[model samples]
Target: MISTAWGISFRAFDIGQLRIFFAFGVLQILNLIFISVFTLYQMLSVHTSLTLLALTPIFFMLLTTKIIMPRMAAFTRQNQEAVGLLTNRVTEAFTNIHVIQTNASERSFQRLIAQENDKVYATDMKVLMLRTLFFPLMSALTGLSQLVVLFYGGSLVVQNKISVGDILAFNIYLSYLAFPLTSIGIILSVYQRSKTALERLDPFFNETPESGSDAKILPFPNPNEVDIQDLHFTYPGSIHPVFMGLNLRIRKGEMLGVCGSVGSGKSTLFQILTRIYEPPVGTTYFEGKDVTTLDPITLRREIAYALQKVHLFSASIADNLSFGLIDRPSEEELARASRSAQILKEIESFPDKWDTQIGEKGLRLSGGQKQRLALARLFLRKPKILLLDDVLSAVDNITEARLIQEFRGIGCTMIINSHRGSVLE
Candidate 1:
């Protein structure tokens, strides 16, 4: 499976195209020497002085490598960054279009997009302009080299050392050399742009995996029980600690209700328990075994966590309900789970029923419908520990009470985090 950073890099750039361009540039460079030697040999055969004309192409390559290529690469990098930023802004605008409309901030968002678009345009123009000037500069140097070859070779003919026909032959070979030289310069320009894309992707390839490949898969005797001793933690980039000397325990088949205010680490607690963020070793344990030593994939198998903010893809009701399931649930199984979550009646009310399409993030559904839909998805999977993080927040008292009844009936060790104190009672 790919990580978050890798996913973002893929969206930001076309990696496959970059590799193709880089390979073409390398192959051209490899063939350049043989082409240069074969063409220049004819000139060297006529007179040794005529071979000095090679300096023109050589000087042009040197200028391209030292000055022109670096500038091209720098601007190419800037252009990529600008384009990526603009893409992010566009995605955000579309995702929150409703919010923008309600706030009457359409012009504000438009201005933001216009500013990013200008940057992308400015950086792209710089790269294109540099490439436009590159070919003409090569031609100018080639023309200058021709003038030198004609004057010196003509001198040889006047002294009767070489025939006039030989001077004509030397100039013809000189013209042949220009094509390969100009081709190599073009290759270098394309190569610089590809090289910049590779640099942007380097960090993703170099990052370390959060879980080790060789981590042990220890079986938990009491997988549903949690025992923490003096747990202390602070989020990254935060000075204040969320938990200090926090000790807690939950027995098997027990339902613990956690009530807290906003930013009080209720969600963070669920994250830590599920190994989303690894807890300190010797502090958190399952069946007396240090959780840090367990494989994250193996450990997460016994836990099913439904987040507060439900995420529904643009898919059918059936697909969203059976998400994360190892095997597709049968029609009967889907109905049972939906019934338990109290969403079956609404789903059945639709003309298409199970096949009905739910728009992105379930935009077609109300807040309570979305929450129950998430619960249905959760009910499809049977884990040893069930973590419901403020799942009943959107529903009314009657709906919440029914869901709580459903939770109690499931008979699993459950930890429910919510702001309502009555949920615990």
Candidate 2:
């Protein structure tokens, strides 16, 4: 019964702003009928009193349906928001559980959960208080209306204007009407709360994502080069500039090394290259074609990036390496790429070899092993332009030297971003 009531209440409220207009029309119609019927009943003969009594309960039920549901909806929506907030808190804490434990913040987490719980509890109590007050007040109002009907009708019966049987029937109808009239307040409350919930969810329904522009068309030119001219950028909500008039270029088959201090716009430059962040008042051209005009997906596919923080999915080594390759690569091709990355030997040592599962973010592997695995994946991509962002940082000097030598041999247009220049040399 509660579910059915909730569904009806929600439907009435969520049908849009038309709810108010429709509700107003309904209330006006009910008011007119209610006034007209009572006035006519007072003037009608005693024989007609029974007919009026029969409709009284039906009129009260209509009042309950139209009036009470909307108010109940408002309270329900408030409770839902409180629950949503509590759930968000729990999810955020769980996601950052490691950091919380590391900092010994169990008490702080508990306090936050407690605070959210208390807020929900208080809101629930307020809703309960409103419900308690609404029911009794409605019941009293309904009883008073019945009392008026009985007194007036009884007097008419005593004066030989109405029959006793007619008066009794009228009283019975009035008694039946009382329950429905009292329920009207509850119905209105339900409608109101549901309306509030739909309003709260409106933003998500109307949301437009950041990328809504049409893609530009530009063909690639000869000499397959990437150029950044007078580029400038700053992150959203940040006051300081991440990049200021930065200019760089990478020609086909040219290996360019990028060296800078920590937080010196290296990663920001890569982000712009990937078109994750739009460059301010400047252009990045790839193979003589404006990168902004080119599709971001195509640009990213052509330009491979291997970051210091390597991320590997929980899948077999072979699956991770061949991620972007269309039509699964031959076993020989996969082996060749793995060998170049110097991780094939390590994989072979594992019990499952290429089929071994690398746990989330490659947690099962050592830092150097993870870096090698990421490089292996990058090698499999065979991109035209490779962006190696501190890929050798985790490996030892010997391994870094060999990897750099191996990378130089690949002959792709490479931009190596790292503080250590010796690896590049």
Candidate 3:
């Protein structure tokens, strides 16, 4: 039966599915036949009524599959979805754990977790109930079937139409039918689960990122400059506009400062400039070419960013610093870049120096150290434009002054987002 189902499901492709399904099905069938044959031989030459009476449990097992399996599959799918939701909630909480704990939100967190747990538990209980109802009902039905077989077969024996041994052989075939029927539900449930899992992941497999027509090889231009005209943007699902009719021009070798209070759309502006979020339809130009016409990867490669929240890989200090460079830098080059960022002394203090692992997100480093390390990485890349989003906030006044003095001679177009007016002065 499983083979037949597989054949129907994959008929358009080939018989490979059928062959695999049939191979397993045949093995199960052989096992059933062996058990039935052994039982029949033991009961042969015995009274026909006695043999029929012993076959009740087998009939009940067959009846259970017909009634039980569909409910179990539905419950399993529900339970999986509940667990997925719970995991998402836990991840979100951990990402904001600092805020939650600071705000004394332990009760709120507990409530949210409890709600998800309750949903999972309810679905789990439903599955248990289904099993409880199925097993006993199957046993009762099998008992009934055996009683009917005994009464009918006994009459046939008395009339001499069939021998007692023949009746026992026939009962053996009935037993074979019972085992397969009982197991059928479990097989179908597995099929349903596998199908659901595939469907859940189908969108990721089917969808590809949109590509522009002008993505072919183009000549690399020197002295990269950017111009934005009437750029407007609103975040997804946001009611208020982030930027409306914003215009700016950034020329080569010029450093620009974008200062604004919290929620003043500073980061949003940077996202627009980088094309991480597309500006409203108009024109954003890069090196005299329209940004919409340029490949996103090419545009980003020319621009280096050091965000307020720096992310580092779990690798050696050298690997993190040299991440954006096309060719691997020599140890001396890495040391020079680190010194230029004023982080070489600190890195050298570590047990392994440049070869030391930073751990996940550079959690092992202090905020100032992480920012400096990120700056080292940006310097290594040597992009045409550098955008530093509040990168100097964590450093002391003297360190901040030293960084600003060094940045002045870096010879790259820079955009600094900072709250410190003294730095701008």
Candidate 4:
């Protein structure tokens, strides 16, 4: 049941105020620049007394960073990706709890999480090892520089070339070098993580938004009519084509059935028709207007596309049925739609009736009940066009029969797909 749409949750959380969090890193970088300059200038003046020896720590930090940053960044990125996969495993496991319990695959799922957790642990250990070592290594270099100063400067004082006061002042300056030098590792660590977080958020920023939200609003004079021309599509990363130069025209108020085997792009076709996955520009048209030029919000409102999988939010049955409409549907409207989907009888059987709670994705209901509930939601919309992808597959033959009988009363354009030819009939 996973989809490309899962990435949208990552997008929603990463936008808005989170964009400004990176600014703190910018200020930190500026501070780093100021200190590095002042510290180097004083140290260079001292380096004149003993050339190359006083410059040892500066060279050490640069050389160590060259060895460490790339490895640190690589480990950090792997850790991030591991965490995401672990999260996905957890989500999918929870969502598919019913199937897992039914098949007694609880241990299998437990093992799955254990395997993913180990991957995350392995990557985390690599990052921790680098972080733990980096600061100490920098501190050692700074101490080495101090030893160089004491040994060389003490001798100069004995020769009466430099005063004791001069040696003491130089040691005070070296103390300034110690704090900033240690902080560099920490500052660089934060900077590297910030950079990685930004890279992870690119999918959210790069998502293709509704292309025509600002375009001229086109009136759907005949909402039931649709024309698709030269439709060609290929999913990301697959070499084989799904569709190439396809064409179709369906009349207003026509009821049609589509028949195809598995992986035939049947579901994908409905997805494109609803503009869930946008079709290429000029390929899909509704009432003679290109779908790409019409606002997706308005287009989806007219075309009610139901996926094979049914998902219901945790809410009362009445609320789930009336989810998308501008105004709350009336009692009579709710009963009628529920009755049409052959679910009103079941709803009336409950003590709470319409007020009964359905848990996440309607886990409180049976598979057939959840499917009928989804169909009821679609019926409540009275959409101009209906795209059903095996929605009736879950219900028993008797319930399916009742729903099919009620379908004639809808009096709107519909496209249905089912493996069972009897449902199509």
Candidate 5:
């Protein structure tokens, strides 16, 4: 993949997207020689010029740069933060475009986006000015060192303390020394940029790690039962709890309808059960075992979740429907699930049908289409338990009724969160 014409996409790309580099770690070992040789050579051959004149200006440059570099780093940090704000605004604007249109709040969004853009422009200017200033300052420091050597070394040669040829050699050596000594500043700058990249990547390190030997092997989780006992949970850094002393039990082949107002923790309950958010120990259990103790991979594979806001990647219809299954779903199976979700007729109407490429997050599909497609994908999995969060909201009454009838035909345990009383019926 690395040698291919397409490397990584720059859009939303970050250090966290270093899968290719980490995979080819051995291939990068050769490049290290260049950095090591240049850096080691400069360190060893630093004092080639013995005179006080040659050494004085170099030391002065070092002292001042140490002070200036910290300021440059601060500017870089602010610039990154400004860029982050711009990114967030762009994401938010696109995601809630429907809401923006419904409320006719384009002007309000325009003003807010303009404000964020101004912040980005101001921070960028600061970084550019500091960077431009750095090069000129470096040039002046190097030039002054050469001037000092001529004035001082020439006088020494004329005084018979040193020969003219000796003074000439000293001048030539100073020129050679200057290149590597000046390079030190460039190296420090590269270091600063790399540090900033690492900072951008820090959040990935905070994610919950995958299970290893320390995790309990749950080879056989009872497909029929899920239980929550006295579950009290809050998000990280949040003082208030979302679920407090919550208890629920779901037995084999039972269909549970969950209905609540907004902010009532319906979706959160599913997230905790699926181990997307770790719950307190002894709080939630699957197959009669604590959910926390179960291997995360096993937990996820056995349970299927479909959220209200469906997400479909930019890919062919068949690919999206078969995304997680160990075996590619056969055409017959695809047709069955799509039919169950009431999307098969629409999908077959496409010129390429299953082969047709859907735009990003199924942009080409209508809201009801996306929801049906997501449901069909989960249906193909035939997971032991289904966690559907308002999946039927977008579809019309007749279509939703048809879907619910087919879904119950599968005979799997299901927990559905829906606001529609018709759905509950």
Candidate 6:
């Protein structure tokens, strides 16, 4: 989704502009041929042999298309790939600058970027050399064709086969062909570059989006129970399994607390429940129906997953709280949600209150504040199942207790994972 929105979006606009330029190029070529054909007919009427002389440049054009064009296209593809890799490296570096600074690994990152930059530079030079060679090669071939025409047509004039006026007129017509012929090479180069870009973007455009069953799944008799049976899951491209024959069931309206040490699949369980990473069909169930058969859009509507690593947008507190709601939530509704999540007082303490602007990923807030903000957003949605993945870990004991009481009163089926036993109790 990020690649579709950011990387391919700008290139889509460039493709549109290329389409416009290519259309104009076609029109110019058609106009050149129309005028050239009339001029050729007049010269042919003067001397039948002169037709052969006018076509001498065709040999040069054929040479360029057959030999030079394929190589140019190959180099263009390499250049584009190199540039894309460099851009990704630069973006990753900036995104993790804080990590690099704290670890004192700036030099290592610089070396990595320099390696990618070197590759980009090499490919760019190859493309530049080809572009530089094209125009001059066309000019030399055109000049050579002109010389051939001058010599042959002058000889025809001396032999009284064609007059001096006829040779001059033929020479004038040939110059008109020069610009169009040279432009054809330039047009083809641009087309090849555009074609390569489209090829790279093809997978993203053709990728099957997250889809649900086209036919409606049968309604569950009990719509509140969450169950897992004989579950076995291994992440793609990894041999190690996260779950093997795991079985569990959470009854309706039950507040099930999950506790485990780090790297013991506590987080992975929540991910499977929320369908962030899909488990095998028939293994995971929600609303008493096979989850894989359910519409992810509708399924997710009733399931809210507040991640351990809270992600907050760089926006006002009210906007963050009201993030997923379809309707514009009233100020009163926002306050109520915040209060339920134990975050209302801190927000109200700010001079701007609900309108306070949180920096990127809530950089202006503490870890506890970010987690509470995410919970507040989830509470506003009023989902059927709440998957809180260590959301209270960062808060103080008093706050955690208050939030725990708040969760109990909500009366929803809750799957709470935590490192602290107090949260599970």
Backbone clashes for every candidate come to 0, 26, 2, 0, 0, 0
Q: How well does candidate 2 score on lDDT at residue 8?
A: 38
Error of 4 at 276 (Å): 3.0
lDDT of each: 0.82, 0.71, 0.71, 0.80, 0.77, 0.80
Q: Tell me the tens digit of each residue's lDDT in model 4 across 1-425.
A: 33433454344432321343456545655776777678667755654665357657779788999899999999978886777677778878887898999999999999999998999899989988999999899889888878887889788889987777767776777787677777778777777765676777776567656753566667655568888899999887788888899898888888888889898888988988877777998999888888877777878888788889997889999989988888999999999999888888899998999999998778789999999989998888888998899998888888888887777578788888898788889
Clashing pairs in 1: none
Clashing residue pairs, backbone N/CA/C < 3 A, model 4: none
> Cα RMSD (Å) per model?
2.8, 8.3, 8.7, 4.2, 5.6, 3.2
Q: Each model's TM-score?
A: 0.91, 0.68, 0.74, 0.81, 0.85, 0.88
| Stretches of candidate 1 exceeding 4 Å from the true structure | 1-17, 41-46, 160-172, 211-214, 219-222
The alpha-carbon lDDT assigned to residue 400 of candidate 2 equals 84
Best by lDDT: 1
Candidate 5 stretches with Cα past 4 Å from truth are 1-50, 97-111, 212-214
CA lDDT, candidate 1, residue 321: 83
Error of 1 at 221 (Å): 4.9
Winner of 5 and 6 under TM-score: 6
Which one wins by lDDT: 1 or 2?
1
| TM-score rank order | 1, 6, 5, 4, 3, 2
Model 4: ten consecutive residues of lowest lDDT = 12-21
Candidate 2 wrong stretches, greater than 4 Å: 1-89, 123-212, 220-223
TM for candidate 5 is: 0.85
